[model samples]
Target chain A: MKGLDLNITIVGLGLIGGSYALALKELQPKKLYAVDKDEEAIKVGEEMGIIDKGFISPEIPLKESDLIIICIYPKDIKDFVKNNIDNFKLGSVITDVTGIKREFAEEINAGLRKDIDFVFGHPMAGREFTGVKYASKEIFKGANYIITPTERNKEESIKLIEDIAIGLGCKNVEKVTVEKHDEIIGFTSQLPHVIAVSLVNSDNLGVDVGKFTGDSYRDLTRIARINTKLWTELFMGNRENLINQIEEFEKNITDVKTALINKDMKSLSEILSKASKKREEMS
Target chain B: MKGLDLNITIVGLGLIGGSYALALKELQPKKLYAVDKDEEAIKVGEEMGIIDKGFISPEIPLKESDLIIICIYPKDIKDFVKNNIDNFKLGSVITDVTGIKREFAEEINAGLRKDIDFVFGHPMAGREFTGVKYASKEIFKGANYIITPTERNKEESIKLIEDIAIGLGCKNVEKVTVEKHDEIIGFTSQLPHVIAVSLVNSDNLGVDVGKFTGDSYRDLTRIARINTKLWTELFMGNRENLINQIEEFEKNITDVKTALINKDMKSLSEILSKASKKREEMS
Candidate 1:
């Protein structure tokens, strides 16, 4: 497992990036470079021995092995890649850990050097907390990793990414189209977070509400403790699909509301019963 | 705690009622009666030693119980109390464990004999599964017991109910107006359930969708496994407040949607930030 001697540079030392640094260490990469805008993150990475080299900015020297993993936020991704593409040699494999893929795939392809292989992927794993402090390789255990490869992605690059995902302890590695990736993610991740934020802020709640909170309330709002800047950028980047999902969700709830208003027990019961059956199947 | 020799009749041997029987057993009531339309529940309650006596129907003799707890569903409650009001002797404190109280409080008060006392109360605790088979005294652990007492309720009756709540191991006992109870529950309980059911049924969800589920998706849809008939009745009873809450939730989400559509990052971030802060406080 440790035979590969490729140099790996992980950009951004946030949760996902830091986890990768720890997990990829098992593969015994020849040289691992950790780059982040935060000086404290680099110091921590160096002290923790997760990095052979640390850089505080993207503009630093980037001559290394041919694998580059970008874990920056959605808005900065294109600019970061465009400015740093020259850091890698020709025939380099570049992948990113962003929630939205279609726009990123398009924008990155438009600006990336022709010889580079850029495959947009998302690791379907996260914690309710953020930062390098909370990052751990255990989070990837039994989690799925998705690769949305464009026409330009070569088989060798896809294999390299999949190998790293498996080395990180992801349970499943599935390949999907960029469009399909966004749609599935819109329903599963973004829509749920939107519901949580809205549900938590749905009322002019008071401090005393904690006394009345039930298990259901706590469970529903567990994800409401969010990172505003990161999620806001992701939402805007995936705005079209997320909005469509919200509309679909609202329509479904409205159907329930109308049935409830009319005291149409049959309709209400049928909807709830179907939901229960489906939920049972899923769980 | 077991020194009291009060006679207690718990009507409706469902989850809440059965749990109450087990919990109140700690107080050592002289005679504990478990009443249910299901003979199986009564037999189980007796065999489990949670009840000294069991009644299959409300038509049976009620005798001279100092306290009566009705844990029946919302629709049949008024009829059950109205039909059995003559069973209890004068000055019996009748409290209910129904979720909704505004209409039932008025109806029960109007129908009860002048000497009878009715204090509408709610135990903010439940399980996804139902019936006496699932009941446990431990469900009351860390749960809040709320009493929505009307002006007709005597001070002694409220104290008796509060005693039973503490006896049941409820962490806190709170007093709320019927109006306030309905409103708060509309947001905390009913609206969240509605969201769960809708989310589970939002689309023609495929069986394979489970592969994409994250902790957030699972948390948000945990209550989607629901009892259709019981929830339908409860929702209809609290229709006005529940519908209002749905509207408010929709409005809140719509604000998020508008912000996302306009790419107004500042507004979106602020909304998510406030929600995160509030969620942090509650948690």
Candidate 2:
């Protein structure tokens, strides 16, 4: 537990999982294993040396692993946890890299063996690009690692997860409740990606006009290339927060529209100025 | 005129105008004059060597200037053009560096003396940072310089402006109509800044969260640190196109929200995929 001598198992073998495997490898774990439903994904990870050992099944590599990390989509979390609940060893800890939390935290804690601690962790790092091929150890270099916990989680387990994040070279580590974590993410992460997708989809301009688009348009739509299937599940899982963020955004846009219709440059400028001020304060 | 012997007078010694002066200086113009109502801006430009001469008033400089480039806000274009219309020498050509055009084009063309020609130009390049101090001659390299024209503009004047842009090392010199130009700007330029400002403003989380924000958020809101007053005027001048863009964005956001609410990850993914494809096509 004090060092990389601990055995670790990563589930899912996709982008986030592959990235964790790579970072864990750098720490030189005593044994590293991975499991994914997709045979091709496991095969690819094996071929890329992204995982020391990998399998194409849901069975947890229970006895050999001191740490188990889940990196599946939100909908897949409950099923994975339910299936593997009996396999976790006593004193071993489990964590995940899913975006949404509260529901999963409740389900995992309620079902897990009381001796096996569960600490939920999410890395605020990703790319518009996806899959194992796009995964990298460097992605965590300047990213945030949020460790969310309920009253049921042991402080020791949370500390272990934080150490793992720090070992992976995460720039910042913070603690928050599952609900607070989701709300912060809904505002900063989920909402931004949602806005990006919409902005890109709405443009009806021809390719030539797009070619004329400067950096702003390109930046605004950078997340438009996201894995919608995964993101949609995350969005739906945290439906209320996503809806709240969208509602607030709708009101902001309505005010902008009103200013434009009235030809009120003064009002429009003031609004933009206010937004700019807030953005600056955040940055 | 064939080489760099031409005297170029840059009106409004701010970022765009200051940048123009710096680039024109590299071609080593015979002389470069800075004309601006903001006396401090002129003084800074002079101190930075962005201008050869800083004029507090327009009269003396306007009389001898061969080419005058107005780089003021869109709303100020008409008055700036009117005040200097009589001062332009016979056969001398004039151009502007405004964002939106149709109205400015009409107003300037109507007020110009019979012997002088005015061809509108917009350089589609900038950083979020502003003013003469941050201006760089290198910004024009590999950036676009768009030439906007109406039927009233003389062909010789268009050629002259194109020649100047080429000499300035602009990567692309495009000729577009005033109306079309404004519409394109509304999407590529105005809409991006608007989205950035809104995204930045929407977040309630302050500096800690900002530090954790990745490149995606930074890129999306890079333009939020804007010159609000100038943008306000640009929005007013191109109210039609800006409003249309805003409405288009609203519809797009609504579509994404509906997808999220329905829990249709496949459709959401498809939408994002389509957006990525469209964005890729945009160049």
TM-score of 1: 0.87
Give the Å error, residue B91, model 1. 4.9
TM-score per candidate:
0.87, 0.89
Off by over 4 Å in 1: A1-9, A19-33, A45-68, A89-93, A113-116, A136-138, A156-171, A205-207, B1-9, B21-33, B43-66, B89-92, B113-116, B136-138, B166-169, B204-207
Candidate 2, B1-283: lDDT as tens digits: 3457667788888888888988888777777898888888998998897788989788777787778888877777788778777777667778888888888788778877887778889877777777788888877776678898778778878988888887777777889888888888898888878777777666765437774566677777778888888888887888889889989988888887887778776777777778777766655
Which one is best on lDDT? 1
Relative to the real complex, the DockQ score for model 2 comes to 0.57
Q: Which stretches of candidate 2 lie over 4 Å from their true place?
A: A1-3, A24-28, A37-51, A57-62, B1-5, B59-64, B163-171, B204-212, B262-270
lDDT (tens digit, per residue) of candidate 2 on A252-278: 777887988987767788898897677
Model 1 chain B — which ten-residue stretch has the worst lDDT? B203-212
Which pairs of residues have clashing backbones in candidate 1? none
Q: Rate the local accuracy (lDDT) of all candidates.
A: 0.85, 0.80
Q: What CAPRI class is candidate 1? A: medium
For model 1, report DockQ: 0.58
